[model samples]
Target: MIKLQHIYKIYEDEHAKHDALNDINLEILEGECVLLRGHSGSGKSTLLSLIAGILKPTKGLLEVDGVSLSKVPDDAATLFRREHIGNIFQKYNLIEDLTVLDNIITPLIPTDLSYSDVLKLADEALEIANISHKKYNLAKKLSGGEQQRCAIARAIVNKPKIILADEPSANLDLNLTMEFIEEMKKLKSHNKTIIIASHDDLLFQSKIFTKIIVLDKGKISDIN
Candidate 1:
């Protein structure tokens, strides 16, 4: 479902050129759950962003869900991401002023979905994320785990073909982490591709991933 070939990402500043990703090549299939393990500055997040089309690769070819992201125009890329990708971040990224239901409905705003249809989608997403009880709560009022679940609901509300999570279990305790993983695993039943970038050892120990890619020094150092 996703492929990257000889990907290189360079950041230029007034005095230095930083290589965030270098000579990386990888492929992830549909309905696969892949874990990316790396320390800080190791380019794991860079790889995810590249696949998500939030950051353009300085050089390389990237294809996601059969679309060549490297060749897509900016406007098309934006639309492609919105239509096909769902991103969950360590920070949750919820809108502070919106209620839980509102945040979940945010992504569908640009679509032609009727209000009732959007609400139905949001309700189903909240139920799937197990955040239905908090639907009326303001995003800022929820606890960390609750907030993260809300973020997940928001991310998957559109039923994107790909799910990208960056440090999704970072803030949760063991139980919550397991809960989150279980929720993520359920997506596989629907044939959604899942990629998680995390340094958490528990994820590696879970034996749930189809593959694990370890990144070091901006390159893929190991795969298992």
Candidate 2:
């Protein structure tokens, strides 16, 4: 339920304009999993940011589940993201001093849910991400895989419809990358629309990915 039409992302400084993405046209259906595969600075992250409403496109239309994101107000886009998007970044964006449960429940803090409800969500998310055993541990004490699992738990705690992961396998070893692939498969089975941006062969090689979109020099090089 994602569509980009003639999309362009241009960053402008005082002296020059650089295009991060140019004339990007794509469609991702509900429940479909796609991989945005490219080297660094090839617009994969920029495209994912556009899809997640973190950055607006400079030209053309972007719609998620029929809502025109490019036209939405800033607050509206934030709300829409809260309601629909789940993100996993390469860096485990967890607070070092916060406990795992606290970190996972951070996203739910803005909602009107009761404390008990928030705890329930955090617990459930931890279970899904296989990080429940670290519930009370400080984030800084966790291992790399544990930290990544915590990030995944936090992202999914909101029960978002679309999952956007940028370079999820970038920091992990082969074994941990395989663990991530398994998690992705589970999410795909749950009918969540998934898109990942990475150059890691572990993710792109998986048969779970319905399609792979390759970007090079700010343009789409191939879609397979």
Among all candidates shown, the one with the greatest TM-score: 2
Candidate 1, 33: how far from true, in Å? 0.4
| Native-to-model Cα distance after best TM-score fit, residue 26 in candidate 1, in Å | 1.0
Residue lDDT tens for model 2, 1-224: 89999999999999999999999999999999999987889999899999999999999999998889999988999989998999998897899999999999988888999999999989888998999999999999999989989999998999998999999988899999988989888888889899999888878778889989999978999998
* lDDT by residue for model 1 (65-176), tens: 8989888888888999899999998888899888999999999999999999999999988988889999999999998889988998998999898999999888889987
- Cα error, residue 205 of model 1, in Å, equals 1.1
Worst 10 residues of 2 by lDDT: 198-207
Residue pairs with backbone atoms closer than 3 Å in model 2 (clashes): none
Count of backbone clashes, every candidate in sequence: 0, 0
lDDT of 2 at 180: 91
* TM-score of each model, in listed order: 0.95, 0.97
Return the lDDT, model 1, position 171.
Answer: 83
Model 1 lDDT, residue 116, Cα = 95
